[model samples]
Target: MTDTTTARKPPTSKNSEVHVKKRRLPDETGIFIVLVAVLLVFSILSPNFRTIDNGFTLLVNGTVIGFLALGQTFVLLTGGIDLSTGANIAMSGVLVALVMQAGVPWPAAMLIALIAATSLGVLNGLLIHYVRIPPFIATFSTQGVALAIPLIITGANSIQVRDIGFSWIGQGRIAGVPLPVLLLLVAAVIAGLWLRMTRQGVHVYALGGNKNAARLAGVNIARTTILVYAISGFCGGMGGMIVTSRLMVGFPATGTGNELFYSIAAAVVGGISLFGGVGTVLGAMIGAVLIAAVSNGMNVLSVQSYWQSLVIGVIILVGVSFDTLRRSRAGRPVFAKRPAVDTPSLPPSTTPSKS
Candidate 1:
């Protein structure tokens, strides 16, 4: 009775604690190395490729795809893909131009364009979450609709944009930096902070890592998914507006197939997992720059457009292959053998020899 209230501890020893080594997760380091190598190769191939003017052109062209890739990163983090991003860009640009042409104020037209783009995202989310459609099929179907809307609206022709103020967003430069490139930088910084420092960002990673586990852990899957797609749409819309400003017209076929290819390729080549739960906006931006560099290098070297396309396709394949291999390696056991355990024998029980 005297010791009844005392807690009895179980056996403890130095060997009781077992240390486990975690396998290092794959990251963008390899991609960065590849980017450096590509840069070196290109720089050596053509003197013009290393020129400051060419560098600026690369950045300017990369900005549009960079924004699209940034948005794609959000969707990819949630284990989803948005095939409709290109179409959303086209439709938003067309709508904005039409509204502006109708004598609407630039600010209001911009807002309307953004809303229209985001609305497509909402519709995509609803189809996936509510109707239980697969992400690819859902987005693919909507892609057709998005592409059609612009064609119908503009009768398949480019619409002129007369708004001088709107043009400044894409054309104006500050401190000798292109406005579009500056916008891309700002967007990348904000997106990077949000994804790395916020709770919702953690949820996104968790959801992508294991959707069932995330749901069990109380992550709001529907809301997160919807938000991700909406972000993608917003980015696509911004890209469209920039392009429209640069061209001084809203081309119904502006983005078309190229947008989808560039956005997805940039994200993948930047080390973002096609399976999701991994990647960084900074890597995506670097990937965009790499792509632009390749294109510029090819142009400087007088490579044919078809050859450029082939090279890009090969790059995409190589990046995806690396990603698949990385994932497969992650699934293997990090430590092949378990730590050995030592157990001490109990002292002979003298009382048991009562016989």
Candidate 2:
């Protein structure tokens, strides 16, 4: 006290105390809440909406496109689009149906059908990865091809599958759960685990976040891109098989307008950004189920079919808008900007902080 000595404090490092708050996981939470709200509303409006029969029907019908959305999730994770999913489904359905009629065993028929579908997917991948074509153009071109192939094979007709064994896989229930739904659930679990806990999953997100950075990080961008599309094709094939079993027929018209619903709805509502780099498999499944629920509810309520389409379109817009907003916020990091390079020169020692 008598000497009036003061100790100087060392400068604090800005990096040590970042004070960043944890962010909420994508808009999927909101979608889930909305789904619950929708179900409640529909149940209140139409008592039939809560019926067990309606529930089972919804599960069966939703399984086909639900699986397609799983593939869409993969493609979108790699910042890619697959416009041919619907067409792929149609082609697979027709192929399987026609093959089953040719005295081929059901399992063998499915193998051939899946191979054909994967080939189409491989073509898309090659065009996008090797030929350097934009994914949009590549998939769209393949979409036309997918649509044409089924027509060519079936001559614009439907091929019915009378095989009871094959039909059971599509419609059978185990402990009251439809087989298709069970398959979808299993696929979801596998896809979710792959994306969340595997190296390839990390690579997919990294590539979507920044392709150059991902490549620099030793991620095989081209291969991942190719694989994502191939996976999408495989999902379509599986969905097609389910559809064939459900109807006991495979028509060239199978899955028409489905690509629009599965891709747009699942990707957007599941928090899979259009700009890429974000999504979850569980979220995609939830999104698909929500859309399916809405459609089913509308049917129960006797709402016009066109009105349902309009509602779905609006939901798509809302989802895409939310995704864009979330991505923008996520990219705005606390330390995103560089510090100022030129600090003002201090005046010749303002009393030099004497000790």
Candidate 3:
């Protein structure tokens, strides 16, 4: 009998293999170049911008918001938006403060805060997935819930966190890095791996690329969408806790209107499409870093606080405009490349063709 198995062929063309490899480096390098240019421009503009102290300070101050933006990355990748992140942050802080004040141990208080935040996420997932409410509407409603809970609990006052040990997660630094920054790194790594390597990652991309196609391909669209929003809420809660710790207090009015930037700016700058399906963890981080740099540079230059908002708004508008232009030039879907179509094996000729 003839052997049925055939030898697997290696990629024959070096050019094809090299072309495949070349793609990996460029996605991030473009962003990196832009970041470097921004840094260079600002350093030249302000002597204080290049100082190590200023850099560390920027990292410390923006760490919590940056972490929240990472979660926003996940939701945005799946073509969903989470408007509730700012609210979640406030609510989580309030929940943590209340538990601690109620004589709960610091660890227990922390756990309670996480649970409260995650519960809010779960609720967002339920509304979006089960109720079939649009993501924008669902998250917007949850945003109200997140904001309201904090006000109800704290009554518009800031609650001080007296336990130093409990505050360490937000305030403590190891080996010269801020604890919040470390947490941000950890969150980024975890998110990056999930979005890059796992089956769920592929599913998320597929869902964003084409919901009907994902469903036809047996990807669980509902589950993935729910999970992404849940993650967004979790990040908000964690960010809230960190901010509370850093300030040593949970203020009800904190993070108001800040969610717009955290969710919108980071994602947009990081190359996450407003229409969804294309983004990366590193890109999101870079975007957050860019925003942080701009804000920090403004501070170093002694620009008025009002001007800071206007600058940030202008940056966002420009970023969005760039993305629009890029999309228009391409004039096709961003991730449209695919493997070659397979040809069916020919059946044995029962009768010779009369060519």
Candidate 4:
């Protein structure tokens, strides 16, 4: 009698094994290189883009997006997103301008706008945390409300800002640096430090990483959620102030434009994961600068606005895909997997022949 086995194993040959190349550089390194390459390419293609003044213009123009992306980084770190930020810009911009026109002092009006925006964020938090509404739906609903508020109040007309001091916020320079740019830098620095060194920041990360685990570890879910959204709102309000200051006008349609989309794209492109809990302020800011550069370069080259949108959309797709792949490969072994080879077993001999 003979025994036989039916098991077969995958081949162990080098060809049979899949090979995943080791990452030669950190994730941020690739995006940083891409940014440099983009700058170089545009500088080579457009002489106008190589000028110092144009560089400053790009930085100024990116301020709103940078602010939105900065706030976005906070919400994303907590595994949430705030779609209402763009609308917050519209709401706050129009609100500030309207109140200023209504005899409120410019400084006071600015305070009111920031408060309104923060209140909007708080509403979103309450809905998401208390009512159990999903972050997406809650923010989307708030976005609509915010978008409509400015239009209803202004009748879709642009409000002219008469306060010259307001211009200082957007147009003034300190040591040849635009105030808005400087403001964004200061905010980014503070945000980065808070996230790295603060206990609350750790709570935000834990919440995003795993809600249950974080809860078990005593993270205050409601406070973290509300706080992140509120911070996002504050950032949105700052963006609103800058927009209003820059043009000396509050356009209701400003928020309805590509600002929201670009802000999200900047965060993702900068390496903020769509799934959350895995990104940095520096990366997001770099992503913002990259998007700004692309936008400025396109304008310099006279590329159509629609084409710019297409390029940004492509960037978003690529960034999300990269993030997804990274997550999937998180725990994978360093080398490609291989299995031992197996040979078939012989059948048993006939008992009659043996007898």
lDDT of each structure? 0.82, 0.80, 0.77, 0.85
Model 4, span 101-181: residue lDDT tens: 998889999999999999999999999999999999999999999999899989999999998888888899999999999
lDDT of 1 by residue, 133-161 (tens): 99999999999999999899788999999
Ranking by lDDT: 4, 1, 2, 3
Task: Candidate 1: give its CA RMSD in angstroms.
Answer: 11.4
**TM-score of structure candidate 2:** 0.84
lDDT of 2 at 337: 21
Tens digits of per-residue lDDT, candidate 2, 1-355, equal 4655667688876664553444455557666766787789999999998999899898787887688888888888777888888988899999998899998988889999998888887888899989999999999999898999889877798988877789887989999899899999999999899887888988888877777767766788778888888888998888888988888898998888745575567666866666667777888888888888888999898888878778877776665565556656767532122221122345786647758
lDDT, model 4, position 151: 96
lDDT of 3 by residue, 227-270 (tens): 88778778887888888887889888777865566557866777
1 or 4, which is superior by lDDT? 4
TM-score per prediction, in order, is: 0.83, 0.84, 0.85, 0.84
Between candidates 1 and 3, the one scoring higher on lDDT is 1
> Which candidate number maximizes lDDT?
4
